[model samples]
Target: MNAAYAQSSVTLYGVIDPDIVFVNNAQTGRSGGQLTGKQQYSMLDGTTSAYFGSRFGFRGVEDLGGGMSAIFTLENGFNAANGTLGQGGLLFGRQAFVGLSSASTGRVTLGRQYSSLWDFVSPLAIITQWAGYIGSHPDDLDNIGGTNRENSSVKYTTPVWNGVSADAMYSMGGVSGNFAQNQVWSVGVGYTGGPVRLGVAFVDAFDPNISMFGATATAGGVTTNNLGSLGSATTAQRNPVIAGYASAHRQQIFGAGGSYAIGHATLGVVYTNTRFVGLGGNSGPNPFGYSGSSTITNVEANVGYQVAPAVTLGAAYTFTKDDGPNNQGARYQQVTAGAHYLLSKRTDIYMVAAYQRASGTNSLGQAAVASVAGLTPSARNQQVVDTIGIAHRF
Candidate 1:
């Protein structure tokens, strides 16, 4: 082991991933208007997070003696194609945390970081670690709805014993009057031995709401305002915030996953269930009283085979089903396959293809909302995307 500042070390690490992509049934413009209909198209890349999501980070560790050490990491996510922050313009959108660790005790960290759900289950699901196009759930429901990464959080991890370990985290709301609003909590355990690894976790989110508009009006036969609609209705519903208070809502997530290695092949499987319940009155347009409950279940599987010391072939699939009040139920499925060739231990090239299909009833029963341009209730739509990219880590 390297000693503290006596042997202090600082390293710069980053990955620059950019990919060219082809999509079928892609809307043309950012406006929901019908600029271009379903057709094959090609682009510079990053359909999902822009290939490698260019990022730079600094990580270091210092020995504090007596079996204790101090560690820190500061990472930022950016769009390589456009040179911009990745997560809603947050500077350290990916992660920013500092912590202390003990060889005999455990580790404690604080800051914006990935939640237990992602830390535990994502490894088993090829999509989360790779990209949204392949492993992502329909609309990223599994990852985001369960609070993929949190802000203002404190986390703890137990020292591994015989390949078994545990972790827990709690997030502060940062709100004055309401202590629980927008807070989050999570706990998990994992075990890895020989050729098998398994983990389980649970997470809860107080309130989280985000939105994105469609590019075109009728790419998947669903018509909506070119700028996308916002409200407490339909799939765009968000938790309501009090007049002078913060939003009040809650989410619970439970997941389990495992992976096994066999010869030169590895296989992984994961299952997650998330529940959301509204706590406040409708802040946006309350077409159906606003307060509602929803549950989402996700299952994913992956397989990877090492073709050579520097090459790997993999395939993955994910299924998601949403059930809720006000005709908000929907089903989403995705299939992905890809391959990677390592240029070195810290660099690689990859090619991946993905297909997504969605079927369900619209939240608005009448389907007459101007946002949805004559979109039929309970329709099925599909999208196909292919990507080729390279990533390097240092």
Candidate 2:
């Protein structure tokens, strides 16, 4: 490992990922009007972190000898397509933290960072790693996509032992009076052995209305979708897949995933359970009429193959089920395919496609329609999306 950094090391790193995408169906309607089942064909990218966030960062390490060291990282998320800051325009929206490490012990860090849950399950999930947020579960309700980071947090990671390691984290809500108002806690563990990797993770958030949806208790909740309105395709940001579920007062998630490598091929699968608690209160002005709580289960299976030294191919399938009030549930199914070609060690290009269909009552008790993880929810029950992009890291 380079003999404990013979010299102090500071490095600059970042990724620029931009894509042009098209959608078959993009939902739109007048405010509080009716649903206008519409189809959209336009150029789209992660203007709102749609997938594989584009970011840049600076990190450094100072070796103290005796198997000890100090480290720090400052990263920023941005819109590579338009040269703008992301993550609510924070200077270091992606991450900002410092910590100490001991070769024989572990590491302890403080600042803004991704939850332990993310460190665990992301590697085994297709959307989180390759497809980016576009493949996230409905609404990214599972955090397999949006807001994957936390602020005012402390984290710990145990030294790897026999290919096994564990991590835990806690985020202080920063509320003066209500200490627990927006607090969050997470834990994860993983094992990486030859040709195989396995992991499981969990997270709980208090006062999810603001923590997840970026709204206050009074102003929290999703806006009412048009009942039956339609619109012509334009350059409008699509709605979240499960917008109505935003009213959830609290959020909880549990997930497990694993990958196995076989020769030139790797196979993986992941399962996640996400829930929104006490929706009645946080539901925005036009709540989804859901009382009590709601739950969603997502299951995915995928395969990756190295067709050549610098070329790869992948395919995947996902199944989602929503358990809403009174046992009225909805169902969604999706198929995905992609191709990636490496231009160099730090640069590559890709093309991806996904199709989805939905049925049953949605989060707001309306007819369910297809919604891809990254694109807008569809007015009808089916939607398709395709994108071509290039990513460069330095």
Candidate 3:
């Protein structure tokens, strides 16, 4: 072993985000006619985690000499509010990866990692950079496909050149006999100069089975299928008749953003568009089809000003629209204002408020229920939320 190789360091990092929230006309349970049997409910709801759905991670690099280095990271997400693992009870839910890199050839890493869509588009939006609920496009369609993350992935990121860079990732199914099920791939490119940035990305998932409200047949007879029982079956068995719906699942996203400084204030703007096709499944006597092409467009603008050396004030507005086959469509608009006070470089206190309104038809043409998967509602049958919180990173 070389003397230089023995000198290596590992670091720990995490963030805490907790907040108080209020929702108007909230439904207690899942959709469908049996919705808690209650008309509406309202209460003080915690928006973020109590402490922070915080994450702890370890990262290290070893010098192999000759300009070569080996690196790895293991990150876990925990609910600071209740001290439980996040991401549906998966350990190291945030990320886990190992890789090798060189000054000459960029880096190649293998493990669970963020897709290129989020890496390229998230930073461009003020809502995403500040408020989690507000920053994401309806359901995070522009960020990483609505709460879905790639697993068993191999990624490559090229070093920056002339303010431009690129990345590609492929997720493996890891199914022994069947190879193509639950696989995903993505590619993206970005450029940044001054205060302007632009990005483009594409994502494709093959036979990525998803669960929906439907029925399944068993030896006993027909039964209402829920997520629990559906998880026990294979992709082929879960929605056998609609298997074609899962084939060639794809999404494409493109965005542009920029900021300009003026005196003590900076103004920013961002725009994004996303397209989805061939998703959802239903196979039975009562078949409900959710597969179709859809388009989502989002636009946002904001201004930030330094109130004092330690205090910053910001305000932003966002608009989103979704158009789908048939009459399934939705529109959302939001306004947000907040202030941050820096107690130290790594610690801060902040307060923010956002108001959102949505209108449209749900998948089933239910007038009261607006079909927007994630966003603020306009009425009781719609979705609306107001949140205030604080975050600290270390």
Candidate 4:
């Protein structure tokens, strides 16, 4: 093999993280399926790690003469404890995309993929950094954690110019006779200069339950055509933050974030606005009896510090509020703190904790309850979680 022809390569990578966790005010069912609150302790996989989820992936690149290349990525999410597929049990559910790239031009990709908001703006959000899964806003309604992905999508990214870049994505509805049904689109712009980074993004989707938030694909590369399983008021484990609006016909999200580094410390702030429009209009049962539109706002600030070469610390605060039809709403406040110590290049030990408080009315038309993104909603208005974990990468 000549050296010139050896420009193609494929790489394998993965991460595994396991944790012992404690949660207070967890809701559980009693003997007769009665709902009651209790404190629980358990071992979980990846949810408390610095990366948020455990995953394995393969990425490849092939040179195509000039300054262009062919690229592809197949990533899988899994639960380390149970050896089961993550992301609703779909293989390669984290990401699966193939595309072409040019040094002077840009890149375009197709397949199941993340939205522009996740790619560009989330980097500055606390959840993308040390805050990890426990820091998500309410039910992660804004998709800041990449929990929601688009199917049957096409994406384009521009080459960086003087530390500035932009990208756009569109997901086809794939429905006969109705091109706009289940459609999703997004756009974002980012800037990186010195120790400062900033981004802004917007997303719009029709029938969001099927297009983005609830989109599900199979191992055979087929996506679900209808709204998947939905949460209802009677569902003991369902999050109350935004469950009532599950039948929303459309959804819009806009967000902006920035980070500034001052030597060993970095400060970040983010804000997002989300709207669930035309509820009770989708092709699913409206169990929560929601109508019209509901609006949500989230604001967060965080700081990370490198106290030593192998030690890092982080803290964050977030406030989320929802304004629904006829002024119905809920409010949430959360605080998180974490510490990490690197044991080696590919391993680390960490501890993270968070507490949340809620008030007003939840989407279930009942009293608001605290709920973290990965955990079940609490039986009361306050909840607390603590976790200690170890992570390894290869």
Query: Using lDDT as the measure, what is the rank order of every candidate, best first?
Result: 4, 2, 1, 3
- TM-score rank, highest first? 4, 2, 1, 3
lDDT (0-100) at residue 276 of candidate 2? 75
**What is the TM-score of candidate 3?**
0.77
Compute the lDDT of residue 236 as modeled in candidate 4. 53
Give me the overall lDDT of model 1. 0.59
The C-alpha stretches of model 2 lying farther than 4 A from their native spots are: 1-7, 30-33, 37-41, 46-51, 216-240, 282-289
- lDDT accuracy of residue 204 in candidate 1: 79
TM-scores of the candidates are 0.80, 0.88, 0.77, 0.92
Model 1 weakest 10-residue run by lDDT: 237-246
- Residue 97 in model 1: shift from native, Å? 1.3
lDDT of 1 by residue, 241-325 (tens): 1111111255677889999999999889889897656724221223334356667788888888889998878887777776645
After the best TM-score superposition of candidate 1, give how far the Cα of residue 125 lies from its true spot, in angstroms.
0.5
Report the C-alpha lDDT of model 4 over 242-329, residue by residue, as the tens digit.
6666678888999999999999999999999999889888633466677889899999999999999999999999999899754779
lDDT string for model 2 (193-276, tens) is 999999999999876656554453112123443222323323222343455665566789899999999999999999999887
Which prediction has more favorable TM-score, 1 or 3? Answer: 1
* Backbone clashes in model 1, listed as residue pairs: 17-52, 29-215, 31-226, 32-217, 32-226, 46-50, 127-135, 223-373, 224-371
Error of 3 at 385 (Å): 3.3
Flag the better candidate by TM-score, 1 or 2: 2
**Which residue runs does candidate 4 get wrong by more than 4 Å?**
1-6, 30-35, 215-235
